[model samples]
Target: MLAIDFQHVTKRFPGVVALNDVSFNVRKGEFHSICGENGAGKSTLMKILSGVLTDYEGDFFVNGTKTGFTGTRDAESVGISIIHQELNLVEELSVAANIFLGRELRHSFFLNEAAMFAESQTLFDQLECEIHPRQNVSELRVGDQQLVEIAKALSLKSDILIMDEPTSALTETEVERLFRVIEMLRNEGVTILYISHKMEEVFRLSDRITILRDGQHVKTLNREETTPQEVTHLMVGREIELIRLGKGRQATEPVLEVSNLSLLWPGHARGWKLKDVSFTLRKGEVVGIAGLMGAGRTELLECIFGASEDLPEGRILLNGEVVNFRHPSEAKEAGIAMVTEDRKRLGLFQQMSVRENITICTLPDSVSTGIVHSRTEAAAAKKSIDELGVKTATAETAITSLSGGNQQKCIIARWLRTQPEVLLLDDPTRGVDVGAKAELYQVIDNLCKDGLAIIVTSSELPELITLCDRILVLCEGHLTGELAKKDFSEERIMELATKLAD
Candidate 1:
C-alpha cells in the first residue's frame, strides 16, 4: 500500500498560486525525492503535506486512510515529522531541552531531565557524533546545530519523515554519517520524503524522483531510469552548461596582499581562529578558499572585511599601501566589499524595497544639496537590475518578493554599485538553483574580465575547481595547501581540507 497519496492538491497565497493540482504517491518504505529550482513550489507542496498550510485545497491519505492535518502537531500525532531547511530550534535552550520540547518526560508531575539528556545522547550516538546535550543551541556552529535538528527529528521515532535540505549546512563527514543513519532507518521501514537542490544527494538516495515547476507537477520517474542531467532539465526546462572561467586570460599585478595574518580566539584553548594566513590576489583573477566546516573560511573573509569582532594581528596592503581598517565602513572606503554567507540573516534588509536595498550602499552618489534624490537612486537601481538580470516586477517591490537566486543577485548588485577593486564572496551559491548558479558564474566571469580581483569561498569542491584560477585549502585555522588551476581535483582538495595543522 502507498504510504502517502496527494490528490488534486492546490495552494494559493495573496499574489501567487504556490501549487496547482499536484498529485503523487509514495510507496511504503521507499525513499522519495522531490527536485525543483528555487521558487518552484517544492517547499509549498511539502508545507501543505506537513500541515504548515492547512487552508490548501487537497485530499491527503496516509496508509490508505483519508487524513487532513490541522497543524504540525496534528501531523506529528500520526507519525509524520519534518526537518525544516531553516532551523526551528530555540536559541536560548539547551540541546536536550530543545529536542524534547513540549514532549518532555515526566515523573510524578516533575520534568524528567535525566531521562531526556540520556535519550538525546543516545540519538547523537546513533548518528556517530559527539555533542553534549547540555550545550546551549546558540553556542554551537551552524553545522552542529543542523545535527541537533536531525537528532530531534530522529527522537520523534516517526514512521514517515520529511527532510527539507537537511544537509545544506553539513560537512562531508557529517553528510556521510547522515546517509548511514538514513540507510538504517530505511531498513527499519521509515519512509522518507527528501527535498534538496543538490542533484548529487537527490540522485544518491532516491528510489523515485518527482519534478515540480512553477506550481505544477511535471513527472515522476524511477531513479534507475533517470539521469541527473535529465532531472535538471525537467527542473529548469533547459540544459545548464557547467561554468569554466579560468581560460586564457592572464592575471595582472597584485591588488591586495595579506601577510602573517592571525586572529586570537579569546577564552579558548586553541588561541587562534586564523593562523598566519598569507595570500596575494591579482587583478583579473578569482581565488577560491576551500575548507571544511569550522576550518575558518568565513572567519578569514570576515577578518579581511573588518567585520570580525576580535581584531587580528596581521598586515594588509592595498595597492602597495599599508592600511588597518577597524570597521567595515573603513574597508569599504578602501575599495573592498564583501557579500556574507548568510544572505537572509546578514546581508539583506527584509523589509526594504529592492531599489532601496541596492542603492543604500551608495547613497552619497544619489544625494543633492543634503537631500536624497529619488530619481537618481531609481536610475542607479535600474542599471544594477539590468546588469545583473534581477527578476522583479518593479524596483519598488519588496526584496522578499523575489526568489532566493534573485535576492542573491540583488545583494551582489548592492556590492557592485560600490565599484570595489576587490570583492569577497562567502558561499555565493549556497541555496541557489542550477539556472541562477550559471547566471552568477557568468557575472563573476565578467567582473574578472573587467579587472576586478575576487576571493570566493564555497563548500562545493567542484564549484571551486570550475571557477577559480587558484585554490587555497584551510584546515583547523591554518593554511594547509594551495593548488593551482592545473592541479585542481576533488581528492587533492579534500586531502588538504582534512589535513591536521602543523
Candidate 2:
C-alpha cells in the first residue's frame, strides 16, 4: 500500500523553481530515504506533504485518499508529523512543555501539569534517553534536545513520521539510541521518511532510497539493488571525483603561536574549558583540530579569534610579536580571519543581500569620503561570487535565498577579501553537500598554496585527514595527541579524542 503519492508536483519561490514536476511514492510501513544535494527540492517536497507549504501545483494522496492540507494541523490530523532540521523547541520551556506545546493535556478548565509530565517521562523512557521531563530545554545538550524532538513526534502517535536531518546534532551514542527507537517503530508498522546527507546511516536503515537533483526526481532504487556511489552520481547528475589534496608544502616562518592558553569554566565539574593548550601555525600550513563534542575544538578556535566569552589566560604571538586581541575586530585587523561553525547564527546576515554580506567586512575599500560606492561594492561581490562559483541569480539576491553551499561560499568570500595571513575554519562543511564539499576543499587547497596559514576543526576525521598536514587531537580540555599526515587514522584520532588527561 502507498502511504504517500505525489504526482507532477511543482513548487516555486519568488526567484526560483524549487520543485519541478517531481513525482514519487512511499510504501506504507517502510523506511524510505531521500537523497539530494542542497536546494535540490528534497525538503521542498516533504514540506508540501507536511503542509508547511500549501500552494503548490500537484496532486497528493495520503493513505489512498486525495487530500489538500491547509496547515500542519491538517497533515497531523492525517497521521503526518515532521521533525524539522532546525530545532523548533522553545528553550525557556521545560521538556514536557515543548513536547505538548500545542496539544496540552487539560483537566476540565485547568492545565494537567502532572499528567503531561508523566506522559513526557514515559516518552523519554521509550526512547531510552535520560532527559528529565521537567528540565528546561535550554539546560540540555544539543543531542538531548534532538531526543526530545523524537519523543515529541512519538507522542503524537503519528504512523507517518518525517525526519529532516534528525541526527545532525546528535552524538554517536545518541544516534544508536535513535536507531533502536526507529527499529521499535518499524516493528509497530510505522512509516518513516528520513532525509540525511550521511550515506552510511541512509544505507543502513533505508529499505528504499529516492534520489532528487535540481528540484526534480531522478530515480528510486531498492537498497539491495543499488550502491552509494550510484546514488551519489544520480543526485549530482555527474561523477564526483574524489578529493585529492596537493603535496604538503615545506613549513616556513611561524605566522601564529599560542602558549598555555586556558579558559575558566565556572560552576562546572571541570574548572576549565581549555587548559594550557598551545599550538603553532607556519606560513602555507593547514593544521586540523580533532575532537569529540565538548573536547574544546571550537573553544580553541574561539580563543584564537578573540570571540570567546571568557578571557583566555595565555599569550598569543603573531608574526614574532605578542598580540592580545580583546575582540574579533582586533584579530581581523591583525591579519586573521575566521569562518564560524554555526552558519545561520554566526556567519550570514540573513536579512541582507548577497552583495552586502560579501562586502560588509571590507566596506572601507568601497567607500570614499564616508560615502559607500555602490558600483565598487557590487563589482567586488561579483568578483567573489565568480571566483567561489556561487550559484546565484544576482549579487543583489537575498543571502538566505541561496543554498547552504552558496551561502557558505559567500561567507568564505567575505573573509577572503580581508587577505588575512591566517584563516580559522570550524567545520566548514558541516551541512554542505558532496559536490559543494569537493569544490570547497579545492578552494582551501588553492588558498594554502598561496601561502595562507589555516587552522580547521572538524567532527569528521576523514575530512581532517584529507585536508590537514597535521592533526591535533584534544580530549577534556587538553591536547592529547598530534599526528603527522602519514600517521593520520580515524582510530588514532578517536582514541586521543576520548582519552582523559591525568
Candidate 3:
C-alpha cells in the first residue's frame, strides 16, 4: 500500500516556478529519502504534502483516498506531521507547553497542566531523552530543542512523519538517539519521509531515495541499486570538482595577531568562553579553526570582529599596530570583515532587494555630499552579482527570492565591498548545496592567492582540510592543538577537539 501519492504537482511564486509537475510516491511502512540541491523545490513539495501550502496544481492521495488538505490542521487530522528545518518552538514556553500547544488537556474548563506534563514526560521517556517537561525551552540547547520537535511530532500519533534536516543542529550522540527513535517508529509500521544533504545518513536509513533537480522529479532508486556519487550528480545535473589548496602559503610578515585572548562568561557555569588563546595570520594565508559545538569557535571570531556580547580581554594587532575596536563598524574601518554562519538570521536583510542588501554596509562609498547615488549603488550591486555568478532575474529582485547558496554569495559580496585585508568566515558552507560549495571553494582560493588573509571555522572537518593551510583545534574554551596541512586527519582533529581542558 502507498502512504502518499503526489501527481503532477506544480507550485509557483511571484518571480519563479518553485515546482513544475513534480510527481512522486512513498510506500507504507518504508523510509523514503528525498535528495536535491538548494532551491530545487524539495521544501516546496514537502510543504504541499504537509498542508502548509494550499494553492497548487496537484492531486494527492493519502492512504489510497484522494484529499485536499486546506491547512496544517487538516493534514494533522489525517495522521500527518512535519518537523521543519528551522525550529518552531516558543522560547518563553515550557517544553511540555510547546509539545501540547493548541491541544491542551482540559478538566471541565480548566487547563490540565499536570496531565500535559505527564504525557510529555512519557514521550521523552520513549525517546530516551533526559529533558524535563517543565523546563523552559530557552534554557535547553539547540540539540535538545530538536529533540523536543521530534517529541512533539511523536505526540501526534501520526503514521506518516516528515523530517526536514532534523540533524542539522544535533550532536553525534543526539543523532544516535534520533536514529534509534526512527528505528522504533519503523518497527511500529510508521512511514518516514526524510530530507537531508548528508549522503551517508540518507543511504543508511532510507529504503528508497527520490532525486529532484530544478524543481522537477529526476529519478527514484532503491538503496542497493544506487551510490552517493550518482545521487550527487543527479542532484546538480553535473560533476563538482572542489578546488583545494596544494600547499601552505609561504608569506613572511604577519598581518593579524591575537595574544592572551580571553572572554569571560557571566551567569553561566563555565567561567570563561575563551581562555588565553593566541593565533597569528599572514598575508595570503588561510587558517582553519576546528572544534565541537561549544568550543568557542564563533565566540573567537566575534571577539576579533567586535561583535561579542562582552568585550574580551585581549590584545589584537593589525600590521604590527595594537588595535582595540569597540564596535563592528570600527573593525570594518580597520579593514576587517566577517561572514556569519546563520545566514537567514544574521546575514540577510529579507525585506530588501538584492541590490540593497549587497550595498547596505558600504553605502558611504556610493554617497557624495551627504546624498546616496542610486547609479553608483546599482553599479556596485551589478559587479558583485556578475563576479559571484549569482543566479537572479535582476538586481531589483527580493533577496529572499534567491537560493541559499546565492544568498550566501551576496553576503560575501557585501563584505568584499569593504576592501578588507582580513576575512573571517564562520561555517561558510553550512547549508549550501554541493555545486555551490565547489564554486565557493574556488572563490576562496582565488581570494587567498590575491594576498587576503582568512580565518574560517567549520563543523565539517573535510571542508577545513580542503581549504586551510593550518588547522587549530579547540576544546572547552582552550586551544588544544594545531596541525599543519601535512598532519591533517579527521582522527587527529577529533582527538584534540574532544580533549577536556584542565
Best by lDDT: 1
Candidate 1 global lDDT: 0.89
- lDDT digits (tens) for residues 1-502 of candidate 3: 9999989999998878889998889999999999888888887888898899999998889999998988999999999999877667988999999999988889999999999999999998887778999999977656578789989999998999999888766645567778999998999999999988888889999999999898899999999999999999999998876465644456567999999899999986989999999989998988999887778888899999999879999899999999888899889999999998767667999999999999999999999999999999999999999988787878999998787668989999999988899999988876677777787888888888888999998877888999988999999799999899899999999899999756
Candidate 1 deviant stretches above 4 angstroms: 107-110, 369-379, 389-402
Instruction: Please say which candidate is ahead in lDDT: 1 or 2.
Output: 1
Q: Better model by lDDT, 1 or 3?
A: 1
Summarize candidate 1's per-residue lDDT along 1-502 as a digit string, tens digits: 8999989999876566778999999999999999888778887788777888899887989999999988999999999988876667888999999999989998899999999999999999998888999999877766788899999999999999999888877777888999999999999999999988888998899999999988799999999999999999999898888666766557999999999899998887888889999999999999999998889998898888999888889899999998778899999999999998767667899999999999999989999999999999999999999988787778998897676667889999999999999999998887777777888898898899889999999888888888899999999889999899899999999999989768
- Reference-based lDDT, residue 399, model 1: 90
Candidate 1's TM-score reads 0.93
Backbone collision tally, model 2: 0
What TM-score quantifies how close candidate 2 is to the native fold? 0.93
Which regions of candidate 2 deviate over 4 angstroms?
Answer: 91-96, 105-151
**Superior by TM-score: candidate 1 or candidate 2:** 1
